[model samples]
Target: MAALRTKIIACPTVGEELRSLLPDGFVLEMLAYGLHNVPENLHAQLQASIDATGPEFGTILLGYGLCANAILGLNSRRFRLVIPRADDCITLFLGSRREYLRQLSLAPGTFFLTKGWIECGEDPYTEYCALRTRYGHEKAHKITRRYIQNYTRLALIDSGSYESEAYRKYARMVADYFDLTFEEIPGSNELLGKLLSGEWDKGFAVIPPGQVVARDLFYGPEGMP
Candidate 1:
């Protein structure tokens, strides 16, 4: 028997709340590191955390495109990245709703708001690749290889073939990043059905790693807003 470990990341506001709802006996942490961009110190801290945690699985849950770049480059073998079925573009765009909407002129109805949240409109993998490119292809490839080595699996939850073009782009990116092994779990209607079918030992969901239940922790009266 092995211990289950997971990393649940969400909006800066919701990380604490999500941590509270997690099951006991599993090592859990929130991705709340603050820095404008990838910094050496932050990377070292991340390395230290990985070494200290020593969990068999690492799951990432937020969609702001902030940690994806860093997470893919971590030097660990038990890492897994999970994103909600909604397109990453929505998450990226909404990182700064006012600015994103003003620049892109995105209508609120884009992608029908998966799980009742805005989309960021970027491919997780492509963006990751871009980050790698910034560092240099060889370095990026090396880091990505390391990331894959540690990454047990990558999955996309709350996804379905019946999504908008934007969401489809997200699906494609997840596939490309993990070589298309991403699973499309229904977010609204048949979420439970999909979870019951999968056998993820150390699962991670963007909203609720391996679950299609997307809750708003950053907005509304109860949300952070």
Candidate 2:
């Protein structure tokens, strides 16, 4: 009999990107975006998804970064859990933990955007539009301002995972609305490819069956995770 395909549990943003890159056959589960805002709930939902998929696949490939440590304590008794050594989607988008940090150091107050975020309608511009509908323009503007107090730049990352000019335009509009400088950064799928290829080197945390994901496992220096 052929081996069963792996199951993928991913953040919706990155999950969308994975569609084109993942092999022809696999089970995919995409959790909603912005779960980073509610780290605890994100953890619970992911743990639940893992449990649900455990019996179905021998391996579960998590298309997520360290993700605020949300995957930290998840146990896998019936399957292996594999995740990239990244703090969040930004690292996944930017290619590696080093590049993500390089951008942060170069512009600490940047709001990063990706094709996945735009295609999924999870950008701040989407939130702003919804707020405008619910709270009216003035109130929405105020709220948006308060929400973006620390951010000074809006960066759209194209990781060569997907391409869309409309997404680029929308991100530019967001920059104009917020009076933040807009920048375009090239993204890479190097690490993302590694994740799918099961190249579980130090760049990935490969939790064997019957073990749990620990914070420390995701906490090492990006080079030797």
Candidate 3:
């Protein structure tokens, strides 16, 4: 028998850059019904649907009003295309950095992309630390290192951290791989929070408008949202 291809379809968040990133083979559509609050009752239904559907790609959608706390039942693979409205900084970088970078680069943009401080402002290295905490620092850093190798250029702004000197030193290693620039500023978290939450109201988060604002939206030092 031939190897099975992954099934890829689930709840969608309406509008977001990631929608554009969906592969040609995958199907994109809204959930069977609107999720008022991550629908606790739907966990079994979702799991059953995913299991019965036997999706090779197994993606689940996250709609507006669905809080992360609502559905703590989901594992990493509950949906291949899991779209959590509010995810931990570290969780975003769970995959290999090189692979993630390649995936990100292949997505549909070339201009400068920015993730607001709401996601990275927690502790400056909140995402990095989250990754390390969840997957270990060495592993997370290794992944970052690998991804850095593939990119020919990188420009970083360390405005999120109060410890500018430390960020500057770390920027050197990243700079060794790609051209890097570090800016020291405080309150990146606050800046990002406002931007994504529509306080600034002129950002990517507003594209697929109508969803809970994140305290912090995690991605990378100089990466996509």
**Higher-TM-score candidate among 1 and 3?**
1
lDDT of each: 0.39, 0.82, 0.36
Measured against the true structure, the TM-scores of the candidates, in listed sequence, are 0.32, 0.91, 0.28
Clashes of 2: 1
lDDT of 2 by residue, 1-225 (tens): 667679889987888778878887788899887677888999998888888774547899888776777878888778888888778888888778889889999899999988777767766677778899999989988888888889999999986655568778989999998999999999888887888877778888888988888777766554333
**Highest lDDT: which candidate?**
2
Q: What is the C-alpha lDDT profile of model 1 across 1-225, one tens digit per residue?
A: 775555543443223223334555444454443431454544455555655544555553333232333333444345544433322233332332233344234222222223222133233354457767589777776665555543333333333323455554566455555553443333322222222223322222323323332333222233321
Residue 14, candidate 1: C-alpha displacement in angstroms = 4.3
Candidate 1, residue 110: how far the Cα is off, in Å = 14
Q: Can you tell me which runs of candidate 3 are displaced by over 4 Å?
A: 1-4, 9-12, 15-19, 55-68, 75-225
Candidate 3, residues 1-225, lDDT tens digits: the string is: 543343333333222222434444544444443442345655544545544554354333433222333333443333332333333222122222233345345532211112322222322243455577778878876765554444443333333323345545554444443343332222123322332223422122221222332333323332234
Could you tell me how far off, in angstroms, the CA of residue 185 lies in candidate 3 after the best superposition?
21
RMSD of each: 17.3, 2.0, 17.1
